[model samples]
Each structure stands twice: as C-alpha cells, then as structure tokens.
Target chain A: MSRALLEVHGISVVFGGLRAVDDVSFEIHDREILGLLGPNGAGKTTCFNAISGVYPPTLGDILLDGARTNGAPPHGMARLGVGRTFQIVRPFSGLSVRENVIVALGGPRYRGNLLRSLTSWRKKGIADEAGAILDRVGLLDVADRTSGQLPIGSLRRVEIARALALSPRLLLLDESFSGLRSTEIAQIEELIRSIREDGVSVLLIEHNMKVAMGLSDRVVVLDHGRKLAEGKPSEVASNQAVIEAYLGRGERGNVA
Target chain B: MDYFATVATLIVIQAIAACGLNVIVGYAGQISLGHAAFFGIGAYASAMLTTKAGLTFWQALPAALLITMLLGFLLGLPSLRVREDFLAITTIGINFIVEAVFIYTPFFGGALGIGGIPRVVVMGGRLGNNQFLALCLVFLVLSLALCRQFARAWAGLACFAVREDETAASSMGISPVRAKLSAFVLGTGMAGLAGTLYAHYARFISAGDFGFPVSISIMSMVVLGGMGTLFGPLLGAMIIGILPEIFRPLIDYRMFIYSVLLLLMIRFQPGGLLGDSSLVVGLLKSLKKLVKPKNIANPREIGGDGDV
Candidate 1:
C-alpha cells in the first residue's frame, strides 16, 4: 500500500473523569476505504470527532500526510485537505441545496479574496465544479431547494457533496447512510466507491455491517473504546471477539 | 419639497436599513441588540467627514461604510465560538462601548451634538438630500437585491447552516465563524450607511439618536415582518414605523399604547406577518384538492423551484 495518508497515533480524549478514547491508533492508506465498526458508546463517533477536529483530542498525534495537525480547528483541517460529514447531516436549512455544496467549494478556506474583481467568474467556476459533484451523487435535482426542506436521504447526499467540494486527500464520513433507505444507502455506497476511485481515502464509521462490508475495503472493530479486531471484511466478520461483542456470545449472553 | 416626500423617503431608508439587519439577525440567526450603534457609527463617520474633513456627503457615505465594515468584522470575532446569552451580552457591550465613544468624544459633539452638517448634492443640480435620498433608495434596492441573491447563494446557505447546527456545519467543511462574520459585517455596514445618509440629509447628529430604542426597533421589524424572508424586513419596518407616527395623537399615552400593541403582537403573532411560505404552500395545496381533484398531491414532488 502507499504511504499512510492519515496516521492517527496514540489518540486519547478525556471528558470529565471518563477516558472516552484511550490510546487509540490507526492508519489509512491513499485510495483506501477503511470501515470503522463499533456498537453504540463504543467510541467510534468520538474518534471521528477527534480526527475531524470537532473537539480536539485531549492527547495524541494526528498526522495528515505527515503534518501534525492534532488540535487545529476544523476549517484549518479542511485547508489542510481534511474533509468530513456529520453523522446527523447538519445542513444549512436557509440555503438552497446547491448553495450548500457551493459554500463548501467556494469558502474562504479555498476561495480567493473576498473583494476580488472577477468574483463572478470565480463563482461561476466554483458553481460548475459544485454542480458536477452534486450531479455525480444524483443531488442536482434538489440544487435550488432550501436545505431545511430536503428529506433525510437528500440531506445525507448533500453532506457528501459538501465534503467532496473540499477536494480532500482524507475524507471522513460519519455514518453517512445511517437513516437512509435501501436505495439511498446503495446510491451512497456507489458514491463512496467513486470517491475511493478518485484516490481519496475514506474512513466510514457505520453501524450497518452489511453496508460497511459491501462498501469498505477493510474493517476495524472497536468495542468499549478498545480495538477489538481488524482485517478484511470476511475475516473481521468471522472474528470471535467481534461476534462476541456484537452478538453476545453463549456464556456472555447467559451472564447478561 | 413636501412632508410626504420626506416621510416616504425616510421610510424607504429605514426599510433598507432594516433589510441589512435582517441578513444577520434574521437569516444568520444572530441577535444583535446593538444595530443602532452601527447606525450611530455611520452617522458620525459621515458627519465627521462632511463637516470637519470637507468631503462631500456622498463621498463620506462610502467612507463611513468602509470604516463601519472593518469595525463590524472586528466585533464579529467574539461570535466565533460564543453562543446564547454570552453572544447577546458581548454584542450589547459593543453597542455601549461605541455609544460611549460617541458620547464622551469631543468631536462627536459630546452633549451638544453635531449640527450644520451639509446637505448632500450630486451632479450639481442642488436637489440636495432629496436627490441623495433617491440615491439611498437605489442603494437600499441594490442591497436588498444583493442580499436576496446571497440568500439564494452559498453565502446565505452557510448562514442558515451555522444557525441550525454549528458542529455538523463545520464537519461539512462549512466554517460557521467565517459565515457568521460575513453576515455580521454585511449587516452592520448597511446599518452604518443608513445612519450616514440620515446624518447628511437631516443636517444634525447626536449619540442618543442611535441607541437601544433604534436597535430594538430594527430587531422587532425583522421578527414581526418574518425572520428569513427577503420581504419581511421592509414590511416589518413599515408597520412599526407608521404605527408610532399614527399613535402621536395619543399624546402622553402614546408610548403606553405602543407598548401594549407591541406586547399583544408579540404574544399572539410571534411568527410575524409572514410565517412559513412552505406551510402556507402546503395548506394551499391541500385546499387545491377541492378544485382540481386530479391525481397531483405532492408539493415536494417536483425537483425544486430552480430560480437560484
């Protein structure tokens, strides 16, 4: 595999008295699809929050392309080519759907001077690029619609479009298809495949093992804030520790 | 030439001012109780230039705008991560500081206030401020149109997104701070421009002229008119502006009557005059079934308006 695009080493987050993520480490390669699997409260989302800079990690080193960016703000991360989507799909409700993608693409983080002379020209270019990305994900139809008015499925896709606009080497999608329908999930899975095809490494945190297995190149299992297992989809699926944690093994079930 | 022209012109000016405030307070979901401070800044910027620096009212207006925009951008820094009561307090504090500067500063005319401010003239025709008032209307229209366009643009989208959810917005690569800052700056600059126009036309200025009452009035116009809609600010300003004028005959009881009216309006009509266009659309769609009765029943069934 190529040199690690994202190297998260010895990351830990302490909240009050609880060690939310204790000594977590992982690597994602260029053009790779890394699946993160863990039960509710298993620290999957918290780890995502740390990597995406939503809340900085209390401890550890996060190197994106060999540059340490542990505690930098999320916009700083975006400027450094780290793009992300929220698990809850928080879109700007007052803005049109296309505008959401445009905002992501044509933000101050990447765009030129605020009072540039040829802003219209730049805006047109940005709009074209944003439109193409949205069209790729079949979200062009809702381009002019206000984001708050979109259904759940469209909002998830809008989040993906926004992330893609960043043109990031590392993209993290937090349960991108959590509340999506069967067809919507399949559409997103295909989009994920296309994103990987574009040489963007994606770390997807998903509860849907079936979808994760279908879309992810490799799976890493976490249980109770610890790395339970990691391997190819089938291998990770067959792992005893994962099965015990997810399905509650014979003695464990009886104990419960 | 006539009082009708003056009042109508001022209404248009205030309406434009309210529209500017709407972008920040309405669409951006920020509560700026210090909007008038910006107005005061604009007035002073223009008054200082036109009276002391020997610049034309037109020239000083833009100058005032540029300075006010810089100050607004600086002030918006606190809103980067602050929320709720803290945000409100910081903004109110900014108002007080700016107001204090105007009140205590000798050049701001201190207690006596700035007078003999020149009437603005353009093209040497000497229509003076009435003509400049026309120009202000033009600026107002331009601002409103631009704001409406932005309301439909990614900039507007960024504002609403941050307002609705900050964390999720940041995750989507939308910087909430940047969006909110832009909104705040745009809103304040427009307010300042309005104040400058008022100063130039009225030929007088005072720190007390732009204070809490003005800020409250601007905010109420936005809320009572409708928070996010383009037309809401102007509509709200017109109603609030005229209501006070009409209640002038009530003499000593005018303010009391105004307060009761405002209270009743707030208590009964929080959504203002224009609430939800979509909800209204839905209601109309349901009502339309009684007429057409054809097999068309989904409002979101279409792709979208596509107006941009």
Candidate 2:
C-alpha cells in the first residue's frame, strides 16, 4: 500500500565456499513489520547482517529509501537510517543506561567534531534527550544504574533503546523476543507496535511461531538458506511446503 | 630548594605525558607503546624550530603540537585496522623504529640530540627554576582540564562504546576509526606539549631519553596511577617519578622494584589505585569494618561467623 522502506533484491551472502544466504528477496513498506522466519542455521541472521551492512552481500543489492546501500560500512548504514541490534545483547557495561543511549545520540554528529564535543553545555541537552528516550523505553528508573547490572529483559530493552536513539527509518531486530519472559515478550510486542506507529519500519528475525505470526504484517520463511514461502499467517500456515518444512512430509497430511 | 624544584618540574612533565597516554590507553582502550616517540618528536620539533628556524619558544610550542598530532593521526590510521595484541605490537615496533630514526638521522642530532634550546623568556628575562616549575604546573593544570573535558564529552563516550564493542558502536553510528584516531591525535598532541616543555626546561635533548624504556615508564605511570581516572596519572607519575630520586642508593634495583610493583598491581588490583574498583577503596572498606564492627555480637569475627 505504501512505498517500500527497504528492498532486499536477490541478495546472496557467501562465506568462502558456503552460501550462508542464497538469493533471498523481500520488501518492507513504510511503518510495516516484516518477520523473517527460519529454523536454526537457516541463514536468517546472515541475511539480517547483509541487509544491515555487517557483511556486504556477495551478490544482489539492498535499497533503503530507493538508494543503493549494499556496501556501506555498518556506521555508514546507521547514519543512513538503518538501525540494528545483535542477537546477543551488547551493552556498554561500564556505562550507565542513560550514557549508553547518549553515546548513540551523539553518533550522527559527524564523528562528533572535537570542538563541539568538548562543550560541556551540549552534554546537558543530549542527556535530556537521552532521558526522554529512556522514559519512552521505560528505563528511566534505572537510568543511572550501570547497564551490566541490568537483567536480561532490561538489557534487551536497552538494546532496543540504543537502536531507537539512531532515529532509524528501518529497525532490524535480531531475535528481540528470545530469552524474554512471557510478560516481557508482551511488553516488547507492544513497544514494537508503538515504534511502528511512530513511522519506523521493523524487520524482525523471530523463532517464536505464534508471536511472529500474530505481529508481522507479512511473513517470509527460509529453509536451508532458500526462500521456502511468503504470505499472510493463515495462508502460509495451510501451505503444504511450510508444513512439510516444519512438521516433516508424513505428518503434513494430518494437519487438515 | 632548587633540587626539589627540579624534581617537582620533572614530575609535572611526566604527569602531563602520562595524562596524554591515559586518553588513548584508558579511555579508548588502545595500547600505545610508542607514546615516548611522540614526546621526543615534540621535543625535537620545538628544539629544531627554535634553534634552526629561529622561531621563538612560544611559536615552536604550537608547531610541535601540530607536528606530533599529525604524525599520531598518520600512525593511528593504519594501526587502528588491527585489534588488541596486534595493535600493541605495532606500537612497540613504532617505538623502536622512531628511536632508531632519532639515532641514525643526522638532522635529529644522531644520538647526541639537539642542544642550546632557548628557555621560556618572560618580560625580557629568562624564567628561574621556580618560575619554570610554575610554568610547568600551569601546563599540567591545562592538560588535566583538557582531560576532564574530554572525559565528559561525547567523543569520550564514543571511545567508551568503541572500547566495549566495536560492532555495537558501529551499529549505533559511531565510527570506531574516528573515536580511536581522535584519542591518538589528542593523546600524542599532549605528549608533544610535555616534550616541548621538557626540551626548553632541560636546555638539552638526547635520543636516549625517549627510547623504549621511557615509553614503558610512561605506560607504567598510567597503569599504576589508575587508567581512565583523571587524578590517577598524576598520582602514578608522582610515585614513579619520585621513587628513583628517593631510592637513589638502590638505583640498581629500580627496574626490579618497578616490575614487582606492577606485578602486584596486576595480580591484586587490576583497576589501579584510583580506579572504580581499586584496592584503596577495598582496603578502606575493610578497615572501616574492622574499626566499627558491623556485628556487635561477633565483633572479633571478621567473617560474620554466626550470621550464616
């Protein structure tokens, strides 16, 4: 219905002789949520890495806002409005929660020019902005606490908050729901919905079937590094190939 | 009095240089074993500018800073590509190469070093030892202020982020290259400032003064004082700089003592004396517990014998 915020066109990523992700294509429109589903070692994370510029694709192109950005460095991609989080949380453990967000806020300022960065007053303004973002992410109470001391669920929120600090047009969340409690998952799902409501498109890699099906506007499944299926939840659920991929060939006939 | 002033001036100079090294090693989490090379470069550049180019000491100061910082930027560009131990080895190699250049290059005085460098001239008069000490103190304060500002700045935060995780830092849009290069450029620039002051104050220069040993000594000052803390380098410089003079009788065992002290620090207190989790604070807490027993019923039981 809207212009695509991100388009991954026939992208393949190969590490040495192994094709980690082979010729996968997808599109996420403005304010849309796209769930990329796969079994373990299905190259889902590799695809995310290629799109987020961690590893440039061995073939094909990635377009953000219709601009070719397949080979930019990770930070270059971030500055161009592609934000991301790791599957394993990476928090600046020594720094406070607020400071972690502040670091991200300062990133788009052209490597923070020496003169401007030296000004102490600007830090106050940036801290205020960090506080507001922390408030939005519900991390305000523990803003001064070191991030390393935070629990896993809070750390996941910190990862999300840090990515949100980039003010990205496209947010690539790699397994944000894993290792979270059921309540935490519900909260994160609501947070993701709000983030999309605020006009940021989301591309999430999820292992949880029900949540992925419930949350994503569209879903694409990968099996053995190849696109297995793509459609709405109900349509994709009844697809013979996806059933066989998930439940095995003999059990597919029993699914009605 | 003059001897005390000289030792104080030397301490101040070393402290300034240590502060610079801390910015790179402490804040940015980059190990540089070639910091003394930059210091020597600053000293040499200032000395040559004043003696050969006929520039005033004041003029040579900024020129030396620029020269040293430029060299730091160039060196940082290639070294930043490597991580951790490889980067450390690269810096160690740089120290050796730079020392060799100073020794063999006739333009750098070929081991003898540049001499007859002009001193600070104030109000048409050469500054006395005390006055020179005062000047160095002023510079030390300036260096400390610069370091404090850097610690509070966004660039410093970026350095911390880069230190924590380069991939995450890049994902957040902070360039690891920029964070590290700035640390190098600023750190080496401060080293240059210290060198310029040292050259003018000492009234002579020698290639042996800025060799690998000096680099190790500066690094020790940062580590011993508490890497990343503002006052840590100053404290470290005081101890390391004054120890030799205080223990002149045992000068032969100087390196031995230093090695022992460093070993103890690393093993017992890796955070250094002033770092967040320092031994000093741990000792203080234990001392407090000893003095005002936390459990009255078991005052003599240090381990809270009956609580469990």
The number of the candidate with the highest lDDT is 2
Query: What level of docking quality does candidate 2 show?
Result: medium
User: How far does residue A134 in candidate 1 sit from its true spot (Å)?
Assistant: 3.4
How many steric clashes between backbone atoms does each model show?
Answer: 2, 0
Question: Could you say which candidate leads in TM-score?
Answer: 2
In the range A71-133, model 1's lDDT, one tens digit per residue, is 888877886788888887778776777777776676654333454411342346767777799
What shift in Å separates residue A181 of candidate 2 from its native position after superposition?
1.0
Q: Candidate 2 at residue A24, lDDT?
A: 93
Candidate 2 interface RMSD to the true structure: 1.7
Least accurate stretch of 10 residues (summed lDDT) in model 2 chain B?
A: B295-304
Span of ten consecutive residues with least summed lDDT in model 2 chain A: A247-256
The global Cα lDDT (0 to 1) of model 2 is: 0.90
Each prediction's RMSD to truth: 5.0, 4.8
